[model samples]
Target: MSLLHAELRLILRSRLAAASLALLMALSALSVVSGLSAVSRQEATIARATAEQARDLAAVAKAYGKPDGEAGYAAYYSFLLTHDRPSPLAFLALGQRDVQPTVLRVRALSLQQQLYESETLNAEQALPGVFDFAFVAIYLAPLVVIALTHDLVTSEREAGRLRLLLSMPGTGLWRRRIGLRYLLVALSLLIPAGVALVATSAPAHLGLGILTVPAVYLAFWFGLSLLVASRVRASATAAAASVGYWIALTLLIPTLANAAITRAVPVSKGIDLTLAQREIVHHGWDIPKAATFDRFLATHPEWRGHETFEGRFHWKWLFAMHQVGDEAVAPQVAAYRASLLSRERWTARLGWLLPNVAAQGILHRLADTNLVAQLDYQDSIGAFHKELRAFFYPYLFFDRPFTRADFDWLPSYSARTGTASWPAIPMLMLLVVTGLILAAGAAQMRRTGRDASR
Candidate 1:
């Protein structure tokens, strides 16, 4: 305990180390507060939008909610609001939430067109992304580690204390110092996150899960810093090397990997799907009712015998044409989804070599803010869309009138609880690689002690 106190005192004596610790803590706290504010704003926006949506629905009902309201016009004009609420832990990572729409209104039209509609986003705000705890942990915490550890041995040697300290110390002397520094750095990073988690009343397991990212990430940085510091005689050189490594891992490699993934697995199929659906729907207008009904009935044979229509624009035929449009582009939709999943798969595979990417992937997954989360939201929307089709199908096929009361029967969208599966293999690979780097650092530090002892 006394030795640990002495180490703390020594660290405080250095203005750079002390200021770095203070700055990191302040930044972390600020990030938590900022994240909380952003989340609150999002929730407020959703509430307002939901209220507005209700009013809009009521107006539509007032206009077309008559007892004899035609199912076709009702289905055409009435819009249902669907929302993707932010996850409880989203404040910590806010990954893709900034750009993705939280609230959307879908009509009984082409699902593909509604699915890919982009949300309105300010380019300036989105250019830099959110200033969340994940950014502090993944990018900035390492610099703090580097600042504290880069000169751990070099400064002692320069101060003419290394030889004497080595001669007088026990076997655990260096370990004690290193361990104390690591503990301090970890505390500085985790304390704000812990407080935020408690404030939000997040699940205990979730707190533990989020804490793991920083634990492993900080360990990796400390190990790399120690490994470099042990071999380098100059502190400046050590810090430079560590910063170079930081840039490569966090910036260069991820950018290059994303570009390559984009080329390797093209997602332009999403646009193609939309265009094809539009083309099919537009062409269905010119084609005969029998042809559209034929195509729709191929998949939905239950409605095969109910393919009778009287007018040039029958509700049943219109609905059938839209259904056929979606079915026609089903393969493109699958291919587009598959391509996106492929990108995520490749990104996870890259976690084997990059600790920053691995930590980011883990945190985003836990916070339910990654591509998977967005995709899950889309899936929930799709499911609700199916429910919408089913509800209206009975009314349209039988030529039953859709009244204002029937609107109550329309299924309300309950945001699905995101089931972001743990990336076990990627996380395991991260642990193994982090362990190896730490081991190497320990070995190098031990060798330094041995050489000094002689």
Candidate 2:
């Protein structure tokens, strides 16, 4: 205990080490605050948009409402707003939300056309991605670890302390030193994250993810440091090598994997779905009314016996065609989803070798900001869209009046809630890689242990 305490005191007294640690802690706290502010801004935008949407809907009701308003016209002209509310922990990961549209206005028009419409985001603001806690922990934390430990053994030898330190019998001072430094580094990374997360009211599981990344990444660095510090005769080489490894593992590999996966997946079907559905909608103008009615009846047999007086503009016939358009592009939508999932699967696989990406996958999955979460939210929107179609079908087909009372019955939008699950396989692989590096480094240190025994 005394030796570990003395060593930590020595390390703190070093201006360079203390400065590096202080920088890391400051950066971590700043990121947490920045992330929280971004999320709060998004939430405020959603709340404001909701009020605007409500007013829009009210105006729509006043314009479309009548003694016997047609369902087809109501469905055609009215725009329903669907929004995916950000989760509390979204501040931590801040994943694809910037690139993707969280608030979309979908009418009874072809859903495929509306779904692909990206919001007008400043691509430049998003080009670098947000510098949230995930960025700090995954990319910067390793560099701090390297700064702290890269010169550990080399400096001791340079100062002529290695010989005397190891000569003492029956003492595992080396392990104690490593453990204490590890604790200090871990606390520096975690304390700010924990405090900010609690203040933000983030879920427990997401906090688990934040803590998990630092542990795995820190372990990997500590191991590499142990090996490099022992093998390198001088301090400079160890620092250079450690920085190189950090850059290659964190920055290089993930970027390459992203490029490869995007090329392989080819998700142009999102566009295809939109174009195909447009063609289906336009085709409604040419098709015979009875034929469209027959097709609508095929799915909705309950409305078959309704009054069907022929007219130039019947609500039932119009709504039928719109639904047919949606059904027409079902295949294309499925293909688009398959492509997105393929991308996610590729990313998950890459996490095995790259601790940085693994941390990303875990954080996003917990925060529900991942591509998978987006897809799930889409599914929820589709279901609600179907409900909207169902609610209006009877009034249109049976020539029933759609009074203001019916507006209250319209389906309300709800966000999706996907369970937060850690990817055990990838996480285990990270731990294994981290273990191997540390063990190899420790073995090197052990080999040199007796040589320094003067």
Candidate 3:
């Protein structure tokens, strides 16, 4: 215990160790602040858009509201804007939100066409990726760990304490040394995260992020530190190998794998689905009205009785065709959605072996900023869009007056809530890895106890 204390004191007094710890803490804090600022900007944008939408809706009412004004004109002209607000913990992870559009404006136009358009982003900013807490933990923290622990064994040997320390009759010295170092590194990383979290008031997550990213990531680094330091004869070699491995594991592999998955999937099917749905909706003007109504009636037999039209133009026929248009691209939509989900599934599988990827999956999932969460938002958007069509379909088909009163009848956007449920499977995998590595390190430490003494 006294020796461990002496070592701790020695590390604190060392310029490199002190500077490294201070640098990591400072970086982590900066990342948290940056993430919070970015998210705040997004939320403000959403608020402004909501206000703008309200003004737009009022203009729509002024233009279209009349006892005689029809539902189709109002529905067509008025874009009901929808937005997904950032999850409270999004400051921590800033995942697909960078690439995915958070704010979307949609009208009675073919939803398939309007749905996939991404928000204007400087691809350059995103290409480098977010400078958020996820980045710090998954990428930078490992480097910090490497710097802190790469010399654990070799330093003692280099100091001429190897034979002497090993020969000292001790049962707990090795465990004590490893545990103390692990604690120091963990504290150095955690203090900054803790401070930032308190500053941001980042939400308590589903226990997934806590288990998977921060804790598991620490274990991974400490394990590598043990593995490299265990066999190395020199401190310099261990440090070099560990840092190189850290760079390759955290930066290179994940980026390369992501590129490969995207190229392989080629989810441009979303675009095809969009074009297909558009064709069906607009072609209704040229196609026989009866054909459009027949297609709509195929799915909605309940509305079949109302299919008969008495004039050259019935609101019912127009609305029915729109419904048919949406249905036309149903298979394509399913296929496109499947492809995206497949990518997420594969990412999880890869995460099992890659701690960086595993940490990413965990943190983003906790913050509800993961790719799956983005897909969930899209699913919700699609469902709400259907509701909008449903709400107006009756009014449109019945030739009901779409007055100011009817404007309020339009379905408002519903943002998803409570998507931060703990993903237990990934957390379990992380736990298993952590235990196995620590257990292995402990066993090896026992074997090295005498060598350290000698």
Candidate 4:
């Protein structure tokens, strides 16, 4: 305890160490606050959307709530609201939420067209990535570690204490110094995050995993710094080498990997699917109504007898045409989704070689704010669209009136539950890599001590 206390005092006495730690803590706290504020804004937006949707629905009911209300008219004009609420740990890593739409209004029409509509977003703001805890921990925190530990031995040697200190101390001198810095850096990054977890009432298991990620991530950086410090004689050279490693790991490698992955796995099929679906829907207007019903009935045989109507413009025919268009592009849609998942799988594989990517992936997965989470939300919306169709089919087929009371029977959409999965493989890979680095660092430190004694 006394040895650790002495090391702590020594570390604090250095202006660079003190200032670096203070700055890291401030950035960490600021990130947490920014994340919480962004989350609060999303919640408020969802609340306002829900309220506006209710008012819209009430107006629809007032207009078409008569005893003889047309089910077709009600289904056409009424738009149902769906939203992907942020996970409890989302403030830690906002992930794809910034680019993806959280709330959508869907009607009983061609779902493919509605699902792919893009919204206006500021490209400038999102270009640099979100300033969340993940960003701070993965990209910024390691520079602080480098600043604190790069001169661990060189600074002591330059101040004329190396020979005397080596002679007087037990063999635990390097361990004491390195361990103290590690603890200080970990606390500086994690204390603010811990407070955030408590404030958000995050699940205990998920919170534990979230806190564990930074500790492990920091260990890798600290170990690398220790190894560089032990091997390099000059403080400036060690700092340069450490920063160079940081740049390669966090910036250069990721950018190159992204380019490779994107070129190798092209996702242009998404635009192709959208255009194909639109074209199919557009062509439906020129074709015979019976042809549309026949295609729609191939999958939906339950509505066979109800296909006949008096006029050239029945709601059933119009809906069947739209359904047929969506189904027409089913193969393209499947191909597009498969391509996206392939890209995600490749990214995960890259994480094994890059610690920054691994830590970023783990944090986003724990927060339920990754590509998989966005895909899950889309799947949920798809399921609800099917339910919307089924709910109105009875009235459309049987010629039953969709009265005011029937509006009460509308099928409400429940957001997906239990979709946040633990990223076990990436986490395990991270731990193994960190352990290897720490072991190498410890061996180097031992060699340094022995050489100093000689």
Give candidate 3's whole-model lDDT.
0.78
Query: Residue-wise lDDT of candidate 1 within 1-454, one digit each (tens)?
Result: 5877887899889999889999999999998898888889889888998999889888888888789988878788878888888788889888988888888898887898788767333557688778999999999999999889989988877787878887875656778778888888889888998998998998777678888878988999888989988888777888888889888888998999889989988787455677889999999989877888878888899877777967666788877888899999988888888888899999988888898889999999988999999989999999988888888888899889889998778788889888555678878988998999999999998798788778
Best of the candidates, lDDT: 4
| Total clashes in model 4, counting residue pairs 3 or more apart in sequence or in different chains | 0
Clashing pairs in 2: 227-441
Estimate the Cα RMSD of every predicted model relative to the unseen true structure: 1.7, 2.4, 2.6, 1.7
Tell me the tens digit of each residue's lDDT in model 4 across 1-454. Answer: 6877877888898999999999999999999999999888898989999999999999999999899999998999889999999999999899998878889999898888888775334557768778999999999999999999999888877787777677775658877777888899999999999999998789999998988999999999998888889898889999999999999999999999999999999886344666788899889899988898999999999888889989768888888888999999898788888999999999999998888899999999999999899889999999999999999888887889999998898989899984676798999999988999999998997788788788
> Mind giving the per-residue lDDT tens digits that candidate 2 earns over 1-454?
5877788898899888899889989998999888888888888888888899889878767877777776666777677878888887788778877677777777755566787766334558777788888888888888888888888888888898888877777788888878888888888888998998787677787677768767777888899888878888789998998888887888787778899999988887466677788888788889877777777678778877782767687766666777777777787788878888888888888887776787778878777788888887788878778877777777776777766656667778777766466768877877888889888988988888867763
Go through the candidates in order and give each one's C-alpha lDDT.
0.86, 0.79, 0.78, 0.89
Candidate 4 residue spans exceeding 4 A from truth: 119-125, 167-171, 269-272
C-alpha TM-scores of all predictions: 0.96, 0.92, 0.91, 0.96
TM-score of 4: 0.96
Ranked candidates (lDDT, high to low): 4, 1, 2, 3
